[model samples]
Target: MPRALVIEDDHKIAELIKIHLKDLHYEIDHTLDGLEGYEMAKKTNYCLIILDLMLPSMDGMEVCRKIRANDIASPIIMVTAKSEEIDRVLGLETGADDYIVKPFGVREFQARVKAVLRRSLGKFENQSSTNNQIIEADGLSIDLDKRSVQKEGIRIELTPKEFDLLSLLAASPGKSFNRQSLLNLVWGYDFEGYEHTVNSHINRVRAKIENDMNKPSYILTSWGYGYRFNENI
Candidate 1:
C-alpha cells in the first residue's frame, strides 16, 4: 500500500479524495493549511502528494518550491481550481509531476494518481537495476542509473515524464510504439485518454535533443502509426 498526503483546504474535496484513494488501498494523511501541510510532508514519508494551489497560511507554489529546494523527490500532483495556462506552466516549472483542475471526475483523479505513482516507482526500480545502466544510440546517451540524458557530450535537461518517454523509445530503437502503448508504458496502467501527454513531452524532448523539433532526427514519428527512435541516427 502506497502512502499519500493530501494538502487541501476544502474539507469536502479532501474527504472525497480520501474516499477514492482509500478504495485504491492507499494510506492517506491530510492537512488543511499550506504551512501545516508542508511541515507534515517534510516530516513524513509519502509515495505521492496531492496538493492544492490555493491554501491558507501559505501558498501551494511556495510549498512546492520549498519541497523541491529540500530535494524531496516524492512525486507531487497539484490540484488547483485555476485552469489558466500560466498557472499550469508555473506548477510544472515548480517541479510538480502533474496537475488536476477542480471539479475533476473521481475516475480521472484516481487514474492520474496511479499514473504518477507508477512512473515514480518505475524510476526507482530502474535506478536500482545495475544490469542495464547506460544506453547509447548514435550521439545520444541515456544514463538510466543517473536518470539523465546527453547528446554530443552536452547534458540535456528533461522533465521526469519526458526522460521516461525518451528512454523507453531509445532503448528499443526503430520499434514503433503507438500513442496508447506509449501512454501505458510511460504513464502506467492507470493512464487513459491522455495521449496528448505523450505528444507534448515528445515535442519537448525533440526540442532539446534534435537540431529542430519540427524536423526531428533522433526521434521519428510513424505518421498514423506512432513514434520510434532512429537507431541508425
Candidate 2:
C-alpha cells in the first residue's frame, strides 16, 4: 500500500478524507497542526500529500514551500475554501500538482487523488524506458535521460507536471493537441472543465522556455484546435 499524508485541521474533513483514502487502499497519516504535519512528512516517504490551506502552526503555502524546499518530490493536492481563481492559480504556481476546493464531493476528491497517483506511477514506469533522446529547439534543450530542461544555457526549474506537459508536446512537434488530449496524456485525468489546468501549465511552461510570452517561439496556439509546438523551431 502506498503511504499518504493528510494535513488537515478540521477533524470532520480529515476523517472524511481518511475514510475515502483508506478505501482506496492507502496507508495514511494525518495531522491537525501544520508544523507537526511538516515534521511527519519529512520523516516518511509518502506517495501523495493532501494538504489543507488552513491549519495551526503553519499555513498551507508555507508548508508547501518548505516541503518543496526540502526536495520532497511527492505530489501535493491543495485543498482550499477560497473560490477565487487567483487563489487556485497561486496554489498551482506554488509547486502543488493539483488543487481541490472545499465542499467537493467524495467522488471528485477520490478521483483527483487517483489521477495524480496514476500520473506519477506512469512517469516512474517510463523513467527508464523513455527513449533517452535529447530534444533541442532554438535555445531550449530537454534531456530526457536526466529529466532536465534548460534554456539559453540556464537550467530552468519546472514542476514535474510542467516538464511532462512540455515533453509530451515537444515529442510530437506540429501536432495540435486539444486540452482534453493533453490532460489525458499528461495528467491521467479525462474530466471535463479541467482543460484550464492544461492552459495554465502551458502558459507557465512558455514563460520559462520562451523569451517573449506574448510571442512564444516554441509553443504556439492552434487557435480553434488547442496548442502545438512551433514546427519551424
Candidate 3:
C-alpha cells in the first residue's frame, strides 16, 4: 500500500484527511505540530505528504523548503486557507507539487492526490520508453538512466521536477510544447489554470543549466507557441 503523511494542526481536518486517505488504501501518519511533523517527515519515507500552511513551531513553506533542501523528492500537497494567487505560486516555488485551498471537497482532495501519484507514475513510464542512454548537447550531458545532469563538465544538482521538465524538453529538441501540453505531460493533469506551474519549473531548470537566464542555450521560448529546446544545441 502507498504511504502518506498528513501534517495538519487542526484535529478535525487532519483526521478527515486521514480517513479519506485511508479509504484510498494509503497507510497514513498524522502530526499536529509543525516541528514534530518535520521531524517525522525527515525520519520516514512516504509516497506523498499533505501539509497545512499554518501550524505551530514552523510554517508549511519552511517545511517544504527544508525537505527539498535535504534532497527529498516526495510530492507535497500544500493546504492553506489563503486563496491568493501569490500563496499558490509561492507554495509551488517552495517545492510543493500542488496546493489545495481550504474548504475543498473530499472528491477534489482525492483527485489531487491521485493526480500527483499518476504524475509520478507517468514519469516512470516515460523513462521506460528511453534506451537508458545519455543525451549530450552543447557541453551539457544528461544521463537518462542515471537521472543525472552535468553542465560544461560540472555536475549540476536539480530537483526531481526540474530534471523531469528539462528531460522532456531536451529529449525532443526543436519540438515546441505549449504550456498546457507541458503541464499535461509533466504534471499528469490538464485541469487548466496551472500553466504557471510549468513556467516556474522551466525557469528553475534554466537557472541551473543556463549560463544566462536572459539567454538560455538549452531551452528556448517559442514566442506565441510556448517553449522548445534548442535544436542547434
lDDT of 1 by residue, 25-123 (tens): 999999999999899888987778899888999889899878865656678899877555566656665767888888888899988887786675466
Q: List residue ranges in candidate 1 displaced over 4 A.
A: 123-233
Cα lDDT listed for each candidate = 0.79, 0.81, 0.82
lDDT tens per residue, model 3, 1-233 = 98899999999889889988998999998888888888888888788999988889998888988887776777899998865667777787777887888888899999988887766545555556887567899999988767789988898876667777888888888999998888777766563776777777788788778889999989999998799989996
The C-alpha RMSD in Å for every predicted model, in order, reads 6.6, 5.1, 3.6
Candidate 3 to truth, TM: 0.76
Candidate with top TM-score is 3
Better of 1 and 3 by lDDT: 3
Error of 1 at 9 (Å): 0.5
* Candidate 3: residue 143 lDDT (0-100): 81
How many clashing pairs per prediction, in order? 0, 0, 0
TM-scores of the models, in the order given = 0.60, 0.65, 0.76
Q: Name the TM-score of candidate 1.
A: 0.60
Mark the 10 consecutive residues where model 3 has the least summed lDDT.
118-127
